[model samples]
Every structure is written in structure tokens, then in C-alpha cells.
Target: MKLSDAAVKKAKPEAKPYKLADGDGMYIEVMPSGSKYWRLKYRYAGKEKRLALGVYPEVSLKDARERRDAARKLIANGTDPGEAKQAQKREGKIAAANTFEAVAREWVENRSNDWTAGHKALTLRTLEQDAFPSIGRRPIAEISSSEVLATVRAIEKRGALEIAGRVLQRCSAVFRYAIATDRCKNNPAFKMSEALKSPTRSHYNTIEKGGFPKLLRDIDGYQGSPMTTYILQLMALTFTRTGELVNAEWKEIDLDRAEWLIPAERMKMRRPHLVPLSVQAVAVFREAAKLSGDRVHVFPNRNDPSQPASNAIILRALGRMGYTGKMTGHGFRSAASTMLNENKSKWGIHRDTIELQLAHVEKNASRAAYNFAEYLDERRTMMQQWADHLDKLKAGAEVVKLRA
Candidate 1:
């Protein structure tokens, strides 16, 4: 028999257990202590299962019966109500465990782990100094666009426009993580661009073909350590980026083969580059091979061989030489490209070959596929002639290749 709501609320304990039936597998079990519970007793797959709702008077007869009817609907539609409740509970546990901050920390940890020593330090420092203080403890989903704008404005106020741009991007990453786990609705950082100020470009001192001869003479005069002098010399001859050249491992260079094999991972293009070496470049690497304690880097910092030199070291060297914006550590490539293209006839180095070695994006499909090594007979002679041009400039001789 169905129990009345008034009777269920006013009834006292009978010092024994009893059941009040609501029909169709729905019933309320009353205990001796006057505690009551809503339950549905049913059979599925030739087995009986009892699905429990909340205890009654707390879960009133009407509400319990309504819940029972909903369960019945689910069962009629080929679903197990008990199994569904358990699945919902499990999902609750996962949602509780994976808070916004928890997921963001996980994302930061994995990315920071794979980074190089320098990059690892930089990323962690940025997050700790700027991100963690504000949103580290706050659940990621709880973070609003205004909160993100606050972090970015803090950077902008300090006159760090580039750094502010980077921080905004990182905050967007946190929002992406929040949305993936059903925490937030969508990314707040997208439309928040209006909060940021306009960007200003800091132009580097780029050397051009017209200024090549004058600059080459100045680079030959950079008064610094034997290591810095040799590094500058190699930078000009090979036209390799200063960072790639400095961080180069001895194993990548084949002095006998007169070639430097830059691996794919180290390169900006993420592809291996075979730099055809001249005799002068090979001599420099051979000289560099003598100094080493344990670090595998060819041109490691003088004080700490375990790491590479700071950008300040090269920049300082440039300052002391009176060649301050005239050329930079990165300008050597421009110097080579300019001189090679200027005297292609005398040097015999093709524009395509020079651009390919420079690692510029060669969109011409046919030209991109041409292998300079396949034409070694022609290339070997050309590489030597190219080295001779630099040697003439380095000797303070009149550089006739200087085009007005």
C-alpha cells in the first residue's frame, strides 16, 4: 500500500523494520530507529538489483515515487538505473579531482620538462612570477577574461610589450585546458585582444650588400678572446647562425670530409643541413677541438664549459670593436649571401645553392629538389673560390666585388 506523506512524516518507530509499497518495484523501507530509505527492487539479466535513493522523510514519498518512475522509464528504454548512478558518481569523482589549477599545472609540467635548460628556466620563471601568484590556486574554469586582462596589464604597465604578448598567449593555453575537461565554456583570451595596447617593432641593425666590404674589414678587427675571434671568423666564412655554430657538437663536424652536418632538431627549419666547408673553416674547427673538459659543445662558455656563452658575451665583444649596429652575431649570413650573389661569376656559387644553404624557404619545387652534393665536382671548386673572396677581404686587400 502507498504510504501517505502526512503519515510518513508523523509516524514513530515501531521497534521493528517494515516496508511501504508504492507498486511497480517502488517501495520505502522503514527501520526500527524510524529511519526510512527509498529503494526500487528489480530483476535484470536473470538477477535482482536494489537501486537506492535518499532516506525518507528527507526523500518524501511523492519525490521517491517520482524518482522511481524516472528509473522505470530508463529501465524500459534498455538502461540499468543502478549502473547509471554509479557512472555518474565516478564522473563526479574525476571532476572533483581535476580542478582548473590541477590541469594547468599538468600542462606546464610536461612542456617545461622537454625544454632545454635555458628555456626550462625561462618558462618556469614566467609562470611562477606572473601566473601562479594570481591564478595558480584558483580553479582554471573560474578564471574570467578580466582576470586574464589583469595579468596582461601588469606586464604592459612595466613596459614589457613583447613579454605581455607572450603572457597573454600562455593564459589562453590555460583556458584551452579548462574547456577540454568541461570546466569553462570557451576561451576568454580570444576577444580580450582589445585590452592589450598596440605592438611596437624593435628593428635590429641589418647589414646590406652595399655595406659588405666596409663591415667585413671591421669584423676582422673585433678585439676579443681567441675563441670569440675564431667564432666571428667562422661565422663569416660558413655564414652559420652564431647560436647554431656555438652550440655545435664535435661529432657533427667531419674535418676530413670538409663538411659540417647540422642535425634537423638543432636547425630552425627542423631539417639537417650539410654545410660544405672550405679549408679555412676546417682549420678553425680543428683548432677548436683541442679545448674541452666534458661538455660536448664546440664553443662553450670559457668560464663554464657545461653551458654556452650568453648573448651578452657576443654583444659586448661587438661593442668593444666599434662595429656596434654595423653588424651582429646574426649578420654573418647576410654578409655571405650578399657577397656570393654580388660575385656569382667570379665565385661561381649559384643563387639557388646559396639560398638553399641559407635555409630560406625555396617554394620553387624543382629548384628545391636539386642536390648540390650530386654535383660535388662543380660545388667543391665553387666553395673554395667563395672562401678566397672572404680571405681577400679579411687581409684588408681591395675588395673588387664591392658593388655600388
Candidate 2:
């Protein structure tokens, strides 16, 4: 018999459970405790099975009939509704476990060996701060391209276009990882680069060769912390990245060998780098040793001896030397690269040797392992000659072309 909403409500519970049938294998089972639930009973493979549609009046008469009809259709197609319901429940649990944030975190952890501490932290922080709040709990497989776009666009709206671009890139990587792991089928973050606003590109300020002599002279005469002077001098001599220079440890340097071996963990390319020290560079290191020899870092922070000097020290010193917005610590690399390439023929230095010294070799993992020491002998000579050339310029001597 078809049950009415009023009859289902008015029907009192008996000494035990009783049911009000609504036809087509649908019924509202009323228990002795007065709890009501919607149930569907049907035959599958000649065996009767029951499926819980929902609880009433939440399920109600109308909704229960709809669920019953749907289950019947599944049965007519030779599928068990009870089994299908169980499969759906399992899928829901799996989807909950494989959320976007879950997949992203897994991806980051899987690549931890390849990334530096700072890089890994920055990548995670970017996602947590920008990408996670919106779509983090959603299943990775269900995240659409528009959803990823919206996440990055929110970052761009805050005037962080560069960060927005980076977040998008990381999200794309996370999606790729999900795909590889079978958590997701497609990368929704793919091909969405054109939607982002381009960030303004600015080059580091650097001086030309003609201005090198005066800059060197100014650095030498600068009235500041002796540590600052030495750092500035070393920056010009080594031309290493600022972070690499500031975070240098005493253990990594060998005064006798005239080499500074930066470990793979500290390098930008995740490869160990060997800086062939010249006589002048070694002299500068000696001066630094006198100040911080007992400390861990070669340029330990003045206030915090345990930590390396802040990376901004060089920029602050340059600004004090009246080179504000004109030259930067990184400008040393630009100056050195320009001068070396232009004078390669005259100085008899191989381009490959110069590039190796600059740590600009191919980034293939296997190749990087051995490439750090490639052209060591030529690089050692090149370093010495380059340092000598800088000394000549600093002394206000007339620059002359060297014979090959």
C-alpha cells in the first residue's frame, strides 16, 4: 500500500519494529524507539538484499520513492544496488583522503631530496598561504582548471604577480604528481599560464667596465665595518651568489688548497661548487679569518654570532658607498661575466672554464655531479689572472690587452 506523509507521522511505534510500505520495494521502518528510516528491499541474483536509503522525515515519502526507483533501475541492469552503494561510500572515503593539499604536500615531501631547505620551505609556504585556503580540501582529481586559475588570480589581485606565477607553477607540479601517482587523471593547472598577469621584469643594476676602477677604489676607501669591506672585496673577486657568500662556513674553505667547496645543499643548482681561490681572494679570506676565525660563519652576523651575516649587508654597504640603485652585490657577477667573455681571447681563457667557475653548467643531475670539477686547472689559472687583473684596475693602472 502507498503510504501518506500524515499516516507515516501518525502511525505509532508498536512493541517492536513495524514498517509502512510505499510500494516498489520502498518502506519506512518505524522502530519501537520511534526512530524512522527509509529502506529499499529488492531481489538481486534471486537473493533479496536491503539498502538504507536514508533516515526519515529527512528522506520523506517523496525522496524515498525516488531512491527506490533509482535502486530498482540499477537492479534491472543486473547490478546490485547494495553493492553499488558500498562502492560509492568507498570512493567518497578515497576522495577525502586524496585532497589537493594532501597531494600537494605529498609531492613536496617526495621531492625534498632535490630541493634546498629554503626552496622547499618557500614552496610549501606559498601554497599554504595562497593556494590552500580555497581548494585545499577538494579532491585532486576533481579540481578543475578554472579552480586553479581562480586560486592564482587571487594571489595576483594582491599585487604579487611574480608570486602568483610561482604558485601556479607549483600547483601545476602538484597536479602532475597526482597524475603520476594515479590520484588524478589530468592536470587541470596545465596550459593556464596565459591567463596570469605578467610581472614586471627588472635587471640587477650593474656598472660598465669603464666604471669598475672607481668602484673598486670606493670600496677600498669605504669607512665601515671591516667585515663589510672584506665582503665587498670578496664579492668582486669570487663573484658568487650573495647567499653563497654570506653563508660561507670556515670548514668549507681551505687556506692551503686555495679552494672554497660549497656543498650541494647550499648551492642554488643543488650541486656542489668549487671556487678556485686566487691569491687575492685567499688574502681577503685571511683578513676575514682574523675577525671571525673562531666563529662558524666566515661572515657571522655582528649581533648574532651563531648565524651568518644578513644578505642585505652588501647592498647596504654599496648604498653607503654612493652606489644606490647603481650597483648591487650581484652586479659583481654581471661585471665579471661581461669582462671575461669580452677578454676571453686576449686572456687565453676558455669560455667553458669561465662558465664552470661561474657555476653555470648544465643542470642534469648526473652531469652536475662531475661537472663541478671539470676544467679545474684552467679555472684555477683563470681565477688567478682575473684577480690579478682586478688588482691592476684597483691600483689605477692603465688597462692593457693580455697576450694569449
Candidate 3:
């Protein structure tokens, strides 16, 4: 029987502090202290359950009726609202306890001290941009292979093939990090290499990228960040990794001496590298230093002053100028290795010095192990000439090299 509001009003204050005479599952319980709380009565799994509907006035009789209808629909769908609420609470607790984002942060802090600040920032940026939106809130142990594959495939759809590849590799490393700590037993991201295979036809080749001087001409016109332009130019001159170049500290440089000392930890071979700075290389730093303020890194992220630009910053800048098909950050090495070796004498640069400057590991382990001679003096001279070669290109002069 549905009792009218007027009837309840006539009997409520004197008899029961509050009661739902006409409502299905709504009532106000007035405590001994004279405060009222709304309660919802429902039957679930063959038992009656009382669900709190919040405090009265806050959860008024009209608002309580709306909530009652929502709960009843859950029951009609075979879901117990009370049990679902408890399960949801458990999910929230577990998500915070074991989320993929949480474990990855742990991995970055714990397992990645060897990574330079530049690399660390880049790694985190990739995760935050490409991976987090989809699965960051999921428990680390619950991120399925399908979820990861979907994320990378989405990057591929945007034509970031190389970035997709790197994301796959880093995602695999994070899951491995989780496994090492026993946070997860199975790597859903493991052995899924074929999923990333690109179908788009590439019309350009990396090995032959340097022979195309027109491409270099195109790069000269790129109006992207001047820092990125200078960066690519330096990569060509030094053949250093993008991370190393951007993270170059002022202390490591000697302008009067024409040298840049990259510490052993920063080198790929885990040995200290002496870059004999060319005239142009020295000039590049002086300009970069002024533009970067006193920030420790040569190329700090514009959006974030704490660290260098992400590894993709230069590459993406290249992409904006249509060089994505023809070149990459690592491609500068191939260009230098090819052009330097091909035109050594033509530019007054020496072949032995160019090879030594490249630190091209002598293939034989025995030879490399025995080799302590880093050809410091000759490489220094040759690096200056190499920088001059680029200037010649800018000036349209023919390359002239010394007789070997």
C-alpha cells in the first residue's frame, strides 16, 4: 500500500523518528543523537541486505527514490548492487596495489639508474603518451597481450613505425622488470614480434641515405626548432647517439682544446669517448649553451625544464620536414661512415682518422681488446676537416681530401 506524504507527516514526529510508509526501499533512521541516515532495503542472492543511501536531506526522499530505481534495475540484470559495490571497492584497492603504471614507476626508479636523465625522461614520456591511456590503470598482472598490442598498433596507425618498435621493446622490458620482482609470472608482451611488422612500402634505403645531397638541402629549409636543426648537424659531425649529444654538459667541453669528453657510462661501449671537436662542433655548443640558459643539458625539453627533450624530439622534428622516409637519428652514423670513408682524401680528411673517430670497434674481439690507441691527435684534425666538408656542401664547393 502506498501511503500519502500527508499521512506519514501526521504520524512520523511523534511515533517513529522516520519511516518509509509509501516508498519501496527508502527510509530515514534518526539516531539517538537526533541525526538521520537514509537506508535502502533490497533482497539479493536470497537474502535481505541493507544498503546505506547516505544522510537525510543530503539524500532526500525524492533523491532516494531515484537511487532505488537504479538499484532495482541492477537486480533485474542479475547483479546484486550490494555485492557489486563491494567488488568495485576491492577492484579499486587492488588497482592501486598492483597497477601497471605503479610497477613501471618502480622499475624506472630501481632498475634504470644506468640510464641518463635524458633517456629516463624519454622512456617515461613514451609510456605516458603511448601506453598509459589504455592500460595504465589496470593491475600489472592483469595487462593482457591484446591490450599491449592494441596500443602499439594504434601508434603504427599514426605512421610511427620506429616509435612503435621501440614502444614494444620498452614495454617488454617493463614486464620483464615486473617478472624479476615476482609481480607477474607471464609476460603478455613476450614473443609478439610479428605483430609489429609494417606493411607500408618504404621507397628509401638507410644505407644509401647520404648520397642524396638534395635531402640535405631539404633539411636546411626545416623551420622546426633551431635546436633540432643544430642537433642533426652535430650528429652528422660527431656520429654520437642522440641521448649523448643532448645531454652534453658544459663541464665536458674544452673550447680552447677543441675536445668534448663523453664519460664512459654515457658511451654505448661503456668506455670514455673523446670527441675531437671540430671548429663547427665547438661553435654549435657555444650557440646551444646560450639558447639553453644554464640548464645542465644541451637540449632541454621546452615543455619541461628538468630534462632534455625526449629522444623522439629530433626524429619527430625530422618527420615534420618529410625526412622520415629517408633518415633517422642513427642514420647520421651511416651517412658519416659512408661519406667520410668515400671522400676522406677529397676533403683533406684521413681514412684511418675517420675510422678511429667513428670508434668502429675492430670486429675481432682480440684486436679490440689489444687496442688501447684511440688515435686522439689525428682524429682531432680529421674531425675539424669533416666539419669543413659540411661547410663546403653548404657553400656548393667540391670536397677536397688529402692523399692517403
Candidate 4:
């Protein structure tokens, strides 16, 4: 018999259980405890089975009837509706577990051992601050390229074009990991970089080839802080980054061995780099040691001996010497590389030895690992020659012409 809404609602619960059947297999089971549950009964493959549709009035009369008809159709086609419903539940659970944030974090954790501490922290902070807020909860496989693009564009809105590019790169890495693990079909973040605003690349100002001599002379004549003067001398002789040189500790240097072993954590590439100090560099270091006394940093701040000198000091010193926009502390490296590479024939130094001294990472991984100290002896010779060449330039030696 068909059941009406009023009949189902007005029906009283008795001492025993009772049911009011709507039709087919749909029925409302009334319990003595005042509970009503929707149930379905059907036969398939010569067997009878029952399925719980839901509880009412949450399920309601109309929804229960629709479910009953749908289940009946499945039975007519020789399929079990109960099993299909269970499969759907399982899939929902899997998708919930494979969310973009979940997979991205897992990928990071799995690769943490291969990354430096700073690299790990920076990568996680970028994802947390930038990408995770909007789309992290969505399933990885369902994330569209447009959604990722919107996340990146948010960063661009703040005028951080370079950071936007980096965030997009991290997102792409996560998508690639998901694809490799079968959690996603494709890397949607891939090639989406074209949608981002490109940043304007600016090269550091540097002295011209013929201007090196004049630049060195000005630096020598400049009447700045004595510490600043010694710093300028070492900056040119070593050609190391301003940050690396300024933050140097006395313990990291070996004056007897004429070597400066910069630890991995301080280096930009996150690898230990060997700086073979020349006689000139050692003399400058000796002066720094006398000036710094027993302070922790070789170039401790004049006001605060506990901290290293500010990196801005180098640029300011150059500016004070009237070299503003003509040279930078970093320009020393470019100047050194240019002269060394051009004079390689006369200098009799291999390009690889010069590159190692510059602390540039090798593109080939296997070769880099095995040859980290491949040409230490050769680098020592090259470092001395480089220092001597600087002295000649400072003395106004005639410029040598390159062979055509």
C-alpha cells in the first residue's frame, strides 16, 4: 500500500516495531524508541537482500522513493546497488586523503633529507604563506591550472613578481610528485608560468676592462674606516660574495694553511667551498685580525662586536669613493672572471680550476660530488697569480691585448 506524508508523520510507535510500505521495496520502519529509518528490500541472483536508504525525516518520503526506484533499476540490470554505494564511499575517502596540501607536505617530508635546512624552511614557508590558503584542501587530481594560476596571481598582486615565479615552481614540483605517485593524471601547474608576469632582470653594475686599474687606485686612496679599507682589499683578492666575506669567523680561516674553509650553511649553494688565500689576502686578513682582536666575526660591526658588519657597508664604501653605479662589491667577481678567462692562455690556468675558485656549482651532479676538491693544488697557484695580477693592475701596468 502507498503511504502518505501525514500517515507516516501521525503514525504512533507501539511496544513492538512496525513498518508502513510506500511501494516496491521502500518502507519506513517505526521503532518503540520513536525512531524512523528508511529501508529497501529487493531480490537479485535468486537471493533477497536489504539496504539502508537513510533515516527520516532526513531521507524524507520523496527521496526514499527515488532511491528505491534507482536501486530497482540496478537490480533489473543485474548489478548490486549496495556494492556500488560502498565503492563510492571508498572513493570519497581516497580523494579526501589525497588533497593538494596533504600530497605536497608528504612530498616535502620525503625529500627533506636531500635539502639543506634553510632550503627546507624556505620551501615550506612559501607554500604555507602563498599557495595553501586557497586550494590546499582540494583533491590534487581535481585541481585545475586556472586555480593554480589564480593563486600565483595573488602573489603578483602584491608586486612580488620573482616570489610569484618561485611559488609557481614549488607548486609545479608538488604536482609532478603527485603524478609520479598516481595521485594525479597530469601536472596542471606545468607551463602555467607563461601566465605569470615576468620580472625585469637587472645586472649588477661593474667596472669596464680598462677601468679596473683606476677603480683599484680609488679604493686604495679612499679615506674610510680602517676596517672598511682592509675589507676592500680582501674583497678584490678573494672575489667572494659580500655576505660570505663579511660574516667570516676567525675559526673558519687557517692563516698557516692559507685557506678559508667556508662552511656549507653560509654558502649560497649549500656546500662547503674552499677559498685558497693568496699572500696578499693573508696580509689583509692579518690586519683584520689585529683590528678585530678576539671577536667572533672577522669583520665585526664597530658598534656591536657580536654581529658581523652590515653588507650595505661595502656598497656605501664604493659610493663614497665616487664609484656609485659604476661598480659594486660583487663586481669584483665579474672583473676577476673576465680577466682570468681572457688570459687563460698566458696564465696557463684551466677554466675548471678558475670556476671552482669562484664557488660556482657544476651542472653535472655526479662530477660535482666527486670533484669538489679536484684541483685544490691548481687553485692555490691560480689564486696567488690572481692576487699578483691585481697588484700589477693597481700599479698601473699596461693592459695586455687579447689575440684575435
Highest-scoring model, TM-score: 2
User: How much is the lDDT of residue 191 in candidate 3?
Assistant: 82
Q: How many residue pairs clash in model 1?
A: 1
Candidates, ranked, TM-score: 2, 4, 1, 3
What residue pairs are clashing in model 2? none
* Stretches > 4 Å off in candidate 2: 1-89, 194-197, 207-212, 323-326, 361-368, 392-396, 399-404
Q: What would the per-residue lDDT of candidate 2 be over residues 1-404, giving only the tens digit for each residue?
A: 68998998898988989888889888888899888999988888889889999997777788888888899899989899999999999998888779999889989889888777787898999999999999999998889999998999888889999889999999999998998999989999898989999987544788767889999999989899999999999999999989999999999999899999999999865789999998889989999999999999999999989999999999999999888988998899988998899889998999878888888856567665556778999998888889888888888775553332
Off by over 4 Å in 3: 1-95, 116-118, 157-159, 199-235, 241-251, 262-273, 279-331, 337-404
lDDT of 3: 0.73
What C-alpha RMSD separates each model from the true structure?
9.8, 5.8, 9.1, 7.4
TM-score of 4: 0.65
Best by lDDT: 2
- Give candidate 4 regions above 4 Å deviation: 1-138, 150-164, 180-183, 192-200, 207-211, 322-329, 398-404
Evaluate residue 101 in candidate 3 and report its C-alpha lDDT on the 0 to 100 scale: 83
- TM-score for each candidate, following the candidate numbering: 0.55, 0.72, 0.53, 0.65
Local distance difference test values of all predictions, in order:
0.72, 0.89, 0.73, 0.87
Clashes of each: 1, 0, 7, 0
Residue pairs of candidate 1 with colliding backbone atoms: 100-140
Better model by TM-score: candidate 3 vs candidate 4: 4
lDDT of 1 by residue, 1-404 (tens): 66688767776667688777778888777788878888899877778999997887678788888888998888888889999899999987776556545676666666653344455557657777777777666656667788888888888999988788877777778677767757778787876777798777533455665566566666666666767766777877787766678788878888888888887666654556778788877777777776642457777887887777665666677777765876677777766676678887765667766776776655887766545354454555556667777767566575444221
